[model samples]
Target: MSDEFTDFHLEAGHAANGPYALDVDPQRAGWGYSSLRILDLPPGGHHSFATGDSEWIVLPLSGGCTVVAGTGTGTDTDGTFELTGRESVFSGVTDFAYVPRDTQVRIASGAGGRFALTGARCERRLPARYGPASAVPVELRGTGNCSRQVNNFGAAGTFACDRLIAVEVLTPGGNWSSYPPHKHDECRPGQESELEEIYYYEIAAAHGKEGVGYQRVTPSGHGRGTDVLAEVRSGDAVLIPDGWHGPSIATPGHAMYYLNVMAGPGETREWLICDHPDHGWIRDTWPDQPVDPRLPLYEAPAGDAR
Candidate 1:
């Protein structure tokens, strides 16, 4: 039951517990690295947790909150950060807070909302920090139908963490993202990494209609045998401990969004990956096609911080 690839598919409400709407720890995932937690807070509600051996990022899926973080051994227990979150994950990029390992952090909100806690286990303890929405790099990738907007919020080299690498991706309705199926199940020195990955989805419902999407994961014959084909929706999730995964399809009527959390035991914090040979050639044709115009959805308002 704990096999990462065998227990890869998790429907909404399957992982719920307490204040956490969904919880996927490394042990449950069988990868021993990455994890994800979705917290639902009510008006004036709060939740607290110890970082322990993992570094975590507090990203608001909707609404705003205040974060107070401190280490048990440190004298300064007043480290507070205000995240001016937005209407929804589909509406705009949001501010976030990074909690270092072995520390304690508390989250309090005057208004209720859902938040994503993306994490990774690591031995190194980095400094607790806050990242503004303005600082997040927005990138549009692929071509035409394959086009998708990527928010490299906590991706490696962009944000400093001991082992965590998190990113948000938005795919337009009827489009395909995570294309050219890629695999990182091997540490090939300069080519690939052996990271474990988690995909948490949040599909956008339009015109009172519900949202739906699909995901696929096939075996890579490297670590574990894996095969999955799943219907994903808001609050749904999938784990990829090892395999060639990709081509996450957004249904015709729904725009899809997913938060990716990844981590590995490689010597360096890297995100190298190998694209599936059969589909890798698709990248070469991108130059001939036009980028999707529906991209860059909900750019943050020009302001101090939002």
Candidate 2:
């Protein structure tokens, strides 16, 4: 790949910084709003940081943790939440905690696990709160080979945030998710919203073998163009500054999961996208086809409100 594409693709361990196993901020991504960090803690380990100017959500990739949000003065406390995380990304929907901007946040895990700190620099500082796993809307999207499961825990309308919009997607092995390439690089009133996005991937292994997948991003001929075709593995990430990104395909025998973190300069925190015209017709075919049987790898926990 060329230097430009290579710059957007971060292999596992290439983006690690300090206590995070993978860290990508607006400054490092050459974008203005979105950021993501993956923290892997051993048993009985803890980590803390200040959420300066940006709102954040502590979503677990694996394992559970207790999150405490407080003022940096070491006196006043904002909130304390306990997350009942899952065994792994493919296991089930997990609860999370959100901390507002300009606060000090600490995370501690009794048994140790991996957590994702998805963030966005925004204008308002919302209150810190806990999100229950039962409240998340589990959606099965697309059909046949395009089938996938979506955990809309932090989607635009599902959960409220100032600017950050995050969600998780799972594609069964030999299937594709994020298909029919789309872009949100322009703020076109009711048509589309401009947003920068980050895709953090985790492919499930089988019998001591590592899994793999593919990601593609194409230029939209507007603003600063972005293009990439990356072979992704666990702990890898792709930064989409502006492009029609999609067709995230999982090779046979390995499931694929990705956490999508998005934010932008638009006045509204919406996820409206303009699909690639040539492939947009694919959506019309989904209505007549049967959804892949492997979909909904797991469902929302029992007693889900939605």
Candidate 3:
């Protein structure tokens, strides 16, 4: 890969700094809004930080944690939220906590776990709140080999945020997700929205063996025209500045999971994308095909659809 592509793909441990196993901010990513950090805490460990000018979601990758939000002055408190996280990314839908900008937050893990701090630079300081696991909208999308399950926990309209739009996707082994290349690099009113994105991946293991997946991002005639084709593994991440990214393919025996963190300069916090014209027609065929049986690896609470 060329320097541009390599710059966009971060291998496991390559982006680690201090307590974060992985960290990417707007300055580091060459963008203005999106950022992500993975915090790996040992059993009974705790960490604290200020939110700065970004709104953040404390989403667990495994285990559970208690999030306490407060003002740094020691006289005011936002609130405390207990997250009963799952065992792993493939286990089930996990709960998350939202901490607004300009506040101090602390996370404590009793049994230890990997947690994702999905963030976005924003203008408003929303109230701190808890998001229950049962409130997530589990959406089964695509069909057949393109099938995937989406946990829209922080997606726009689901959970309120100023600019952060985050979601988790699970693709069965041998299948693909984020297919039929799409781009949100242009602000076309109702047609599309300009946004920078981050894809954080985790591939499930089998028989004590590791797994892998692929990610591709092509030029979309916007900005610097980001291009990337990466062989990704657990803890790896891909940044999308301006490109038509798609076909995140999982190898035959390994289930793939990815957390998408998106934010941009647009006024509205929405996730509207324009599909690559050549492959846009694929959506039309999904109506006639049967969704893969392995979809929705786990179900959310009944009637809790968002």
Candidate 4:
């Protein structure tokens, strides 16, 4: 692929720091508001981080953890939270903990695990909170081979954040999601909302081999050019600063999962999008077809692996 594709696609090592398999801050990503980082911890491993001016949620990708947060640099602990995580992204939904801005957070887990720090630069300093997996809304969208499951754990309607919106999408093997090629890079009343997005991938391995999938993003021709059609795997990521993104495809036998973190400078926090006119009609056909039977892959109560 050309730079148009490569520019948006980030290989595993291209974005890493310590235990973070993927780290994209507003500055590093050349955008504002949205940012994401996935941390991998070994058994009994502990890592401390500072949430300078960003409000964040510690969502688990695997395993459990204990989070201790404090306001001051010294030892005046402000709050502590326990997160009962899941076995993997393919597992059921997991509980999460939110950390306020300008705070220090220390995370320690009894067993190894991976955590997604979904965040957004914000002016508000809301109180730290916790969200249970049971409370997360799981939605099934599209139909047939286009069917997908969405865990709106940190979505605008699900979680109360100053500006952030995060969600996890699971597309069963051979299915497609993020369909109809939608764009949210323009703020059109009753039409669309402007938002920068980050797509972090985790594809399930097949037959003892590394899994593989595909992602697509085309420029909306609004002066913010971005074009990409990249092959992705576990730990890979795609950035959508401005463009129409969709059709995250899962190959046969290799289910796909992506964590979407989005935010922008909009006055309100919402996820409104406009589908490509050519493919917009796909939405109309969904009503006639049955949803893929392989849905609700796993219930929220898979006996928390943590």
Candidate 5:
């Protein structure tokens, strides 16, 4: 809605299909990076992309596919990357990897699948390559309340990059994530890290029915700010530049999945959020409760499209 980003609402899938969509030109959304889109695909069908000014990440949302990433800056021999999309990876959910700008990347599905992808202009300039495996792994620290796998961009300095740090989180149904209502929009080393953030979502289907998820971000009113409390199904996204956000409330029907893409002017991408001073005491309560039983590590038959 601002000059910072270019908006694309995108078309939704059929009720028989799953809720899946792609987001691009994050800067238009006030994001410092660029993005791409993903949905359903037919066998032998392929998508080719020319990297813009910023780098991009090429991840598969669902079903596996083959990709060729290279410096094919107008030529065909730059080289290609062959990857097998996850067999059980929900076909229309989750993200892949960060794609560097100016590179030529191509993707072809083995049997045609669906996916959700985001491409951001890379501030941390670096050379483009195919299948550059260099994301540092970090596990969620809290209890069963929510567990996730984080790609520590700050730790994995494999490429000379800047302006963005990305992380992927998976939450089981009924389980709560983004607990404690934390915010990392302000950069304050060891105290409060600052950075504008965006939440890109992909919820897994359950028992032949679609799954649902929600996210909330509210401003503290130190000045003129905004608050967002949205019911986000798969493919939908919410932007959060400044505020106290948390309790990524999930429904009891099914588990959820989402990818968080964040970036700020500062050099570090570490997250630092100040909780609602009144609710700051909740972090202590997590150790006592059991995570929601509906959360899914892997559910099949798929739910309805969001």
Candidate 6:
């Protein structure tokens, strides 16, 4: 399946006055048929909803929020998990998913907080988190940029989870990250493989200016030179149903971050990519290289970039 890309502009406080507007559907974006939204809640207000699809996930990018998630099969409602704020989440620093055919859920913000939501359909439900026994954390560090961590979830779990696998990549500087293009659209026999994917981005800028960045994804193979370039900022998203994606280029002015959620029909969810033969080896050469010194991970109190 090939992916599609579309740009959206969401006003910070323009939510409809009803329960909740279906908002923006990313599935319609020509990717894996998913939906995403950045929801704003009034202080002490509550938003409770269910997904029409078999799976869904709710993530908090800023502020605090309380969530109640259950098996959806139980009647008593107490058989649920309660998560408060980003620090208390079981998955990504500010993200988590709710799976299975139908799961009833509710979320509320205490004072100020917004959520970056991403969901996709799947044959089965993948566990919320993986590893802990003896999982090693790999950190990618750069200047002005702090370190980003990757917990080999699928690797440490020994592939016990479902088809939907994930990894956590954090960025601290307004730096160009996720560089060195890679792809996984085709499955190789035993050694290399591919999987269609969608990237859900989350970012936070300083007090004034809005955070800004760009992403590039291109197809691999001879004569397949199509490419996609998207300028994505907070609440903006891009999809990669099939192609090599990289260099989530962040403006060298503010600190930003994003989470890459991916899954496919393939048996394994490992992060495997067939590089552009032209630059595939760059990944092997970055061990001794230094991150670009011009990148700015933290944003100035000034307004967002135009």
Model 6, global lDDT:
0.50
Please write out the lDDT profile of model 2 over residues 87-180, one tens digit for every residue.
Answer: 9999999999999888999999999999999999998988888899988999999998999999999999999899999999999999988999
Model 5 lDDT tens row, 178-241? 8777766556677876666667777777789887787877776532254777777876666666
lDDT of residue 240 for candidate 2: 90
Clashing pairs in 3: none
Worst 10 residues of 2 by lDDT: 1-10
Candidate 4 residues 1-306, lDDT tens each? 221233679987778866788888888777778889989999999899999999899998999999888854444326788998889999788999988888989999999799999999999888787788888888999999999999999998778889989999999999989999999998887779999999999999989998889999998986358888999989999999988898899999999999999999888899999999889988999989999999989766534333
Local distance difference test, candidate 2: 0.92
Task: Give stretches of model 6 more than 4 Å off.
Answer: 1-27, 31-35, 70-78, 87-99, 125-138, 141-161, 166-168, 172-174, 189-193, 202-207, 221-226, 290-306
TM-score of 6: 0.68
What TM-score against the true fold does each predicted structure earn?
Answer: 0.95, 0.95, 0.95, 0.93, 0.74, 0.68
Tally clashes: model 3: 0
Q: Where does candidate 5 stray beyond 4 Å?
A: 1-20, 34-36, 71-79, 88-98, 129-138, 144-161, 222-224, 287-306
**Candidate 4 error regions (>4 Å):** 1-6, 71-77, 302-306
Looking at model 1, report the run of 10 residues with the lowest lDDT sum: 71-80
Worst 10-residue stretch by lDDT in candidate 6? 297-306
In terms of lDDT, model 4 sits at 0.88
**Candidate 3 local lDDT, 1-306, one digit each (tens):** 322234899999998878999999887787799999999999999999999999999999999999999854444238788988999999999888999998989999999999999999999988888888898999999998999999999999999999999999999999988989999999999999999999999999998999999999999999878889999999999999989999899999899999999999999989999999999899999999999998779987544332
Which portions of model 1 miss their true places by more than 4 Å?
Answer: 1-6, 71-78, 300-306
Residue pairs in clash, model 1: none
User: Lowest summed lDDT over 10 consecutive residues: which window, candidate 5?
Assistant: 8-17
In order, how many clashes per candidate?
A: 0, 0, 0, 0, 43, 13
Computed on alpha carbons, the lDDT of every model, listed in order, comes to: 0.89, 0.92, 0.92, 0.88, 0.56, 0.50
Candidate 2: misplaced stretches above 4 Å?
1-6, 72-77, 304-306
RMSD (CA, angstroms), candidate 5: 6.8
